[model samples]
Target: MEELILTIVKPLVDYPEDVKILVNEDEGRITYQLSVHKEDMGKVIGKQGRVAKSIRTVVYAAAGSTQQKKVFLEIID
Candidate 1:
């Protein structure tokens, strides 16, 4: 899951090395905190949050097979 988020975000940022993803799992829920260089925030989030929504949708779909677990994505500056 961490790798997936990294793969998706690295290409969108000017500083790929600055992209960081932290995963926390508890109580059957998985939370992913994604932090990128400040300049790349807009690229990851996109206009009006469309890109962020798309990223979340993909994550949800990928986790659909594991219905017992819930996935959450947080994009941090």
Candidate 2:
């Protein structure tokens, strides 16, 4: 899961080395907190959050239905 996120986001940022993801798993949910370089935040999020939404969509779809827990992606500074 981390690899998937890295693959998707690394290319979009100016500071690829600053990209990081923290995973939190609970009884019924999984959250991926993604943090990127401050300057790259706008690029990852894009205009009106369209890019962020699209990234989340791809991630959720990739997570699939086999998992019992719901998956979530959160972008942070």
Candidate 3:
């Protein structure tokens, strides 16, 4: 899931080289923390959080399909 998100978002940011993704899995859920260069934060999270929402949706779907689990994307600084 993290890889999918990374693949989609890395190219869109100003610092693709600085993009990082961390994934954690619990009993039934998974969370991904995505970090990017500070300068690219605004670009990753577009108007009204639309981009964030889209990323989350993709993570959710990927997890559901691959692991039958619920997944969340946490865009961290």
Candidate 4:
């Protein structure tokens, strides 16, 4: 899951090497934490958050057929 997230998100940022992702399972939900260079934050989020929304959508879809749980994405500084 972390690899999938990285594969999809790394290209959008300025510092691909600085991109980091962490996943945690608590109860029945999964939370994904994405950390990247400060300069690349806006690019990852995009205007009006559309880019972020798209990313989450892709992650949700990719997680399909595995578990019937919720997925969450967070950008951590």
Which regions of candidate 1 fall more than 4 Å away from where they truly are? none
Q: Please write out the lDDT profile of model 2 over residues 36-68, one tens digit for every residue.
A: 999999999999999999999889988875567
lDDT tens digits, residues 1-77, model 4? 78888998888987999999888989989999999999999999999999989998888888776667788889888
Error of 2 at 50 (Å): 0.8
Top-lDDT candidate index: 2
Which sections of candidate 2 miss by over 4 Å? none
- Best model per TM-score: 2
Give candidate 2's TM-score.
Answer: 0.95
Cα lDDT computed for each candidate against the true fold:
0.88, 0.92, 0.85, 0.89
The TM-score measured for candidate 3 stands at: 0.90
* Residue 70 displacement in candidate 3 (angstroms): 1.5
Model 3, which residues run further than 4 Å from truth? none
**Native-to-model Cα distance after best TM-score fit, residue 9 in candidate 1, in Å:** 0.9
The positional error of residue 43 in candidate 1, measured at the CA in angstroms, is 0.5
Model 3 poorest ten-residue lDDT run = 61-70
* lDDT for each residue of candidate 1 in 51-73, tens digit (9 for 90 to 100): 99999998888887765889999
lDDT of 2: 0.92
**Candidate 1: C-alpha lDDT:** 0.88
lDDT of 4: 0.89
